[model samples]
Target: MNGRGVITQICIIGAGPAGLLLGHLLRAEGIDCVVLERHTPDYVLGRIRAGVLERVTVDLMERLGLDARLKAEGLVHDGFNLTDGERLIRIDIAGLTGQHVTVYGQTELTRDLMDARHGRGLEVVYEAADVALHDIESDAPFVTYLKDGVQHRVDARIIVGCDGFHGPSRKAIPVSVGKEYEREYPFGWLGILADVPPCNHELIYANHARGFALASQRSETRSRYYIDVPLTERVEDWPDERIWDELAIRLGPQAAAHITRGPSIEKSIAPLRSYVFAPMRHGSLLLCGDAAHIVPPTGAKGLNLAASDVHYAAEALTAFFRRGDNDAIPAYSDRALARVWKAERFSWSLTRLMHRFPEDGPFERAMQVAELDYIASSRAAQTSIAENYVGLPV
Candidate 1:
């Protein structure tokens, strides 16, 4: 195949939530763009991801004109549980924050974005191989990528690295221009998705002597559950029955009684980490989502954070193109980082407050109990937790 280069205003790498949403939003604003993904469409759809949507995420989807299916199919969760074996504390999101989170799988949301893109005949190059960035420091930046063993190029006014942690975009930014901050936990969450109905109406996060366990769901009948495991643990080591048994012990008797065990459709171990790359822009190339930061799953902030990044990027890029405004570009990085750090703090605080750290001693464990006790009894603490859970702002 012979290649003739394509040119556009914005060339986005990685068709994940951030890239696709930004692409769709830019199109709605009459900005020209294209998206590239290293994975095939089916592979992207099959990936299992969390679904607790902050009110802002829901609003963004509605603005994209993709909320019809989400509204009809998603579950509205007014509250979630935080437990310490002997007791459970439910933070009423609606009562305290005047907002309710919606439970809709990330897979479903991505599918909606994909469908919207296709309906508008937007281009997304799938299975892009060996993608690379060029001349990001100059006004004219471009992308070179391989597709079906053939080389192709996209020259654009701006390039976005919505690509992920391991993607080339951040690496393309010289280390001198950016600083990276990261923390890797000693344990990982071993999660599973099963077809059985969820045990409760809302998600449950339990802290026990053994470890942390969570009961979450994708839909009314499709359940998701996870248990914290040492870094040495493997999915092969956790048979279905063993996982169910451990979940019961950690969640204690009351929540365990409602458990419905079934064969898992998907299972994996995800290591926890908190990471942020500062100054998310390097000239014409900017980073978003995992390409810029990562939060532990404890606060369910990963996907929501990605959506917010897209929100900021879409607005900034639109203004830049429409009015020749240069301010929103640099401002986007600073503004997004402020919120990213707050989310990092929330995830870090929650992880420490709930999980049984390998190095935690008696006093550390007591701190967990004390904090949970206070949160359970104090309305102020509950409100604080509820506001963060529902998201702070844009």
Candidate 2:
């Protein structure tokens, strides 16, 4: 509220889960920080995102004592299934890894974090327009943005970019300083959200002869489903009945029989991509979440990866502020990227396994069938998939 500018130890760009989670963690440690977002609170909550919660994500919520609703409402999934149109190959994550994932919507998780902000004394500035990063390579970093037609600057020892891929924070880094890595898929996921019971209690990732389809749910009554479509496909071309009919065909008989078709509340087609930017840190600026990397939604790693990044960034920032451990700040990039790469690999592998590529011939199709067969027959294969699905140790 200072007329000149605001001063804090850390300035977070983006009030998404990644940014807000980092803000909460730092606040718990008695650190002073401010979060800036280009959108309104409602806009942030309206973004439909991945629903699966890895243990790392749930743990962070538990640590903040923000799991009251999450624990009561979140569905604990012991395992999920992978099918090849005919048979269901189950990966018993709880039995194999002694761990499970929670089916909690990213929107609800963000809401939990947002609701706790005022009570916890966390400062988040929404509708922060034209936000930009400045002097990131220097010892002192800061951010500037316009709020309510007033220009303001926030001075901080560190500025974390939770602002996401399209945000100004990542663009602030000179192209010469960062190496970009990306892979764009030939197809996109056409998703539909409806107020209907899911076809299955557990998630089913199906690889049919036609294409890939995933059956997922946010709650007992709310369902989300997706089918891989050519990048050229448009949402307008597929109506509710068309989607449901396609889902019935692709998800196989078991799922189709139980599917309760209803009008879609939300529907969209999102192209898939695997992207990573090297050395997530440059001088005083550190990147977290989508600003650092993006994983295809195949393995449900998008939001979970962001939570892991925030976990690392929070630890590093807390160390620097409390113990004056200079090494943690410089080492944050390596620490976070270690896990990021693994999640990226899993997502990529799953996407490849389930989706039928445009260029893929009979040989490629045969290989996918062979791999699914191997995974179905081998306990070791199931174990590896289970371990990754539940997420690796943070």
Candidate 3:
């Protein structure tokens, strides 16, 4: 569309949910853009799993005409259970605040988005595409990438780095203005997917002296579960019997026996951590989603936070592209950081409440239990959790 042979006005890197959803939104607005992904569509669609989504995200998908697939397949969780060895306390999210979380994996969301993008006849380059970004201060920021063993360069009015934490977009920003804050927890989550029905009707967050265990469902016949373990532990070290024994101990005596384990479709240790980079922008290049920040999965804010960030970026970019106003660009960091900090606080609080800290004494453990009890008993506290868990309004 330009003299430089750039086919689109914007080029988006990474076809993850954030990138794909942003592409969908921009396409609906008749904006021209292309998406580049590092993994094949099948791999991207099969590997990632994110079980929590806020009401705002679901509403946005519905408004954007992207909810049909989600509605037909997604599981709506109206409540969550908190257990401390013997007693089980359930917090009804919908009853508390008229909001609920939808159990949809990030991979599934990516699949749906890719389907939508393909249906619209949009282009998405996948598998080992190398992207080189240039001209952050100029009106036209060119993206050079390789496709099919051939080098290609495309010039665009703007470039969006929706790639995740491991992608190259974040490194493109000059290190002088960017400061990354990170913390790696001593523990990681051993996530597993089984073909059995859920052990509980709702999500169960069980805290025991052994560790933290989460029992959640993906579908009627499939369940998703997690157990906290040392960061250095390997999946191979956790045999089937060991995995089940840990789950049973943490889930307490009420868990159904003989719950079948599927082919261990997914197994990995997700290292817990919190990361944030200030100013999220340098000149015209902007970062969103995991490219900007990362949070421990304890609060289930990773995917939703990414969606919120991109939504804000879309709004800002729309204003600039249409009216030539630079106000939004300058305020991008502050605007996004506000929501980022709130998520950070919630994530850390949840992590603290559930996990056993190395330095935590009896008093701290008692305080954690008391906090959990307070949340379960107090309507005000439950409402606060519901509002955040179901997602805050964008």
Candidate 4:
């Protein structure tokens, strides 16, 4: 101990979006916090996968004056395209919900948050640290970590675990009372970011006899595309030519103009899955972001859900620090789970509608097409999509 004090105001684990954003929020409220991340700054900023930003995410960033970089570099999409080989259906999200999805990568989001934290002179410990939490029952709980080859103990009033799915925070919860819901699809997305312009004005989610293909953009010059492949397929098995050939076939001839095979800046496999853990809090170790739940990328809810988690966690912490009341803290899991489940459902629905199931017969295929047609034609169905896509009223 440096003898500065026996306890810190707050300690946040994982410097991902949730952890970084929570640190920023708490700092804004004059609360001091230390963020410990297992990965280095470079690794965290570059190694993570990309994701879409929902309208609510934009709103929150704007509110925090953190939208400058996002607005400058992000692509704003009005809607998405659902196609079945020859015919295309465009669901205009702006017209339907008065909001649009932003094509900002999760890595960019992490960079922005990291920048904001640094701009405010916040302390974020990157690289492997001996992070361990103890004395949760005490008024002053503590986190012990190593930095610069030296062990340091931080006694904090509260520890907010914003570390993602693989973090240690969730394990700290002894016999969690809530249920776990999860689904792992047989297919995984082979995502590639290339130095090519997008083939379409909006995202194209194609359901084909071969597999699923998604056409999205990162910027005016860079395109992000994905093809559904066997989960067992390795990235090393896919060469540049093979990847483009698959994309060309699934995207149809219109994609030929924009699908130039160039040096890929990024390529990785994203497994399709939906997961949730009830009651996001266990004592002072409150789980947020992927630490508590994860959703398939089909609905573009992963990063948005993380932001939402931080939002609720911040509010709860504010209430606790201000009033000494535990109501918000206890209700944290319930409140977050409501939206988590909604996103889970929406992601599953979207995945089912756009991906061809291996076991589906003709009847199931017809029903899926009919459901798509209904969504495109029915005002009520469109409104439901709009609400969920734009975000559930925050």
Candidate 5:
């Protein structure tokens, strides 16, 4: 609301879940912030994402006053089934770890955050064009962008980049200071979103001779499913009926028998990649969520990881603002990465166990089956898997 543009204590880039949630947390602490998003609110809402909510993620939502809608509409899953071609094994996460995950669509969660933010008369500028960062390593960092054919600038004490992978925030980190490590899977997921009842009440992840297929849901009447395909595959390559037929074959008769196939309202192929950037904080710029790291969708850690990052950033910022002691601010990257690496390991391991790697030999495949079998038979193994699925302490 300042004359120069939107001056505030913090200027967050990208109004996705991470940015929005960070804004809400900061505002709750009486900190001033403005969110800048490149896409329209409707476009942001139109995006589809994983629906799994970790225990910690749910706790964070409760703190943000967003748990009521989630509790009322979200499905609580005690366990889920994992299949390795023939036999299906159920992992009782709730029983093993005393915790469970919530099946709530990221879209709905994001909408809730947006609603809460807007209802409080907070600022979230949509269609922010050509977002650029200036002197982030300096004490006086600022942000500039175009809106309504006019350029705007904001002088901010701290800049938070909650933008996704392709966002400029990470790219602005100066190559010398930012070191990126990435691993791209040779395969991608061809996922479908349909307005039909899910095949099962809980998610079923199956690995068949053909490939990997997952049966998931966003709501009681809406289903989200996915099948593994080559990186070169496109959504056009898999028609609606073809996808259903493939799912039926891959999921096997046990789960597929109840599948209610219908016209897909949305369909796309998502490429999987495990990426992370070192020292998420440099100068006054701090990266959160996808801006710092990315995980494969298999472990459902993407959103959860983002939530953890925002948690650390918000807490550190609060300390700096309240006590004027900024020691914790510099340790943000280390604190966030400790958990980031753990989540990354979990996601990577799960993806390897439940997917048919193109280059996996018989030995590799045997090890995967052996690990799955151990988890199915051993209480210790099950507890380990359950703990990771339910989420580690933030």
Candidate 6:
């Protein structure tokens, strides 16, 4: 280490999937990089998140030769259902779009990346404290953090923030330089995870008069379900039985009949929000994943979106470092944001179609019903949903 800092070609903040995946990708190309995380390894893997994997994500893993366990364990979902409390309107994504989404847990995918770190020679410093970014607008950007009672610094040619929305990298950018777009929903998702079989082989997104519900699975033997609840409600207020009962009603009688209720392994209330920050890059600092944008979980795009960000970032960094391409660095923001806006739109539209807003009255409800009816009847509508559901090409 130099007197100033540990010098590297690239420095990545946040050891979440986005950061880890980018680290691995850079390493595979013989690039020197380091990742910093504010949390322990266990804490990072403990977070419960969406897992629908698009082709872009699958391709990256495959390209890295990291899909052995994923191929062996991931479930290939051909289609998913949308309902209006009466019947299911199945969108055959694979049939219509010739594409499929893999049902894999975010935790599991992170585990795969984590386990492969040592073999790939990727350095990830967990429990990094008070991480701060410096000179992002200048050619030489560096990161500093306190670890194990010693303050350390990392000087790099580039800094990528995969640290999520609340992380320091994004905040380091001058507020005047970036524009914020956000929509906070009136309700939140109350999700329960259990070690039981899913009610259905495929996902079911239901819009009942009572509320919105989604029945999903992490594996053949593990299920995850969610129901929209007023933001005022607390996890303590809804007991296991109460959540199960609500799921039964909102998911409709057909899905309810097959529900295998079990003790919740994890349960929480997550507020829904759609947020984006324009110009994902500011000088030497580049933002990826949640640091740049966020989407509601309605379309299961959160993790996949992060993966796509890493994909674009890895390519851009590789070009800059390997070929001395100055243009790729500046072009990264626009390329990543193009896909980000589309995913945000899809998630927002799906959330609007499925959730019952407190301000929604007869007209809004009728519009939702009409839209659902049109989607059910029209092949073109289903094709559009299928394309977005499986994800757009990167």
Q: lDDT per residue, candidate 4, 256-296, as tens digits?
A: 55666787888899888788876788777788889889888
CA RMSD, predictions in order: 0.9, 1.1, 2.4, 2.1, 1.5, 1.3
User: Residue 353 in candidate 2 has what lDDT?
Assistant: 95
The per-residue C-alpha lDDT of model 6 at residue 134 equals 94
How does model 3 fare in lDDT? Answer: 0.82
For model 4, how many clashes?
Answer: 2
TM-score of each: 0.99, 0.99, 0.94, 0.94, 0.98, 0.98
**What value does the lDDT take at residue 274 in candidate 2?**
99
Residue-by-residue lDDT tens digits, candidate 2, 5-88:
999999999999999999999999999999999999999999999999999999999999999999999999999999997799
Location of the lowest summed lDDT over 10 successive residues in candidate 5: 1-10
lDDT of each: 0.92, 0.95, 0.82, 0.82, 0.91, 0.93
Model 3 residue 310 CA deviation in Å: 1.8
Candidate 2 has which clashing residue pairs, if any?
A: none
lDDT, residue 221, candidate 5? 96
In the range 1-394, model 5's lDDT, one tens digit per residue, is 3235666899999999999988988888889999999999999999999799997778888997878999999999999889876688888988998889999999999999998887765689999998999999898999999888788998899999999988989988989888988899999999999999999998999989899999999999999999999988878888999999999999989887999999999999999999999989999999999988999999999999999998899899999887786797898999999999999999999899999888899999899888888978898987888899889998
Rate residue 277 of model 6 by lDDT.
94
Regarding lDDT, does 5 or 6 come out ahead?
6
- Estimate, for each residue in 1-394, the C-alpha lDDT of model 6 and write its tens digit: 2224699999999999899899999999999999999999999999999878888888888988999988999999999999887789999998999889999888998999999999999999999999999999999998999887788999999999999989998999998999999999999999999999999999999999899999999999999999999999999998899999999999899999999989999999999999999899999999999998999999989888998999899989999999999999899999999999999999999999998899999999999999999999999999999999999989
For candidate 1, lDDT tens digit of each residue in 206-278?
A: 9998899999999889999999999999899999999999999998898899999999999999999999999
Q: How displaced is residue 30 in candidate 3, in Å? A: 1.0
lDDT of 6 at 49: 90
Alpha-carbon error at 41 in model 5, in Å? 0.4
Cα miss at 300, model 6 (Å)?
0.8
- Name model 1 segments beyond 4 Å from true: none
Best by lDDT: 2
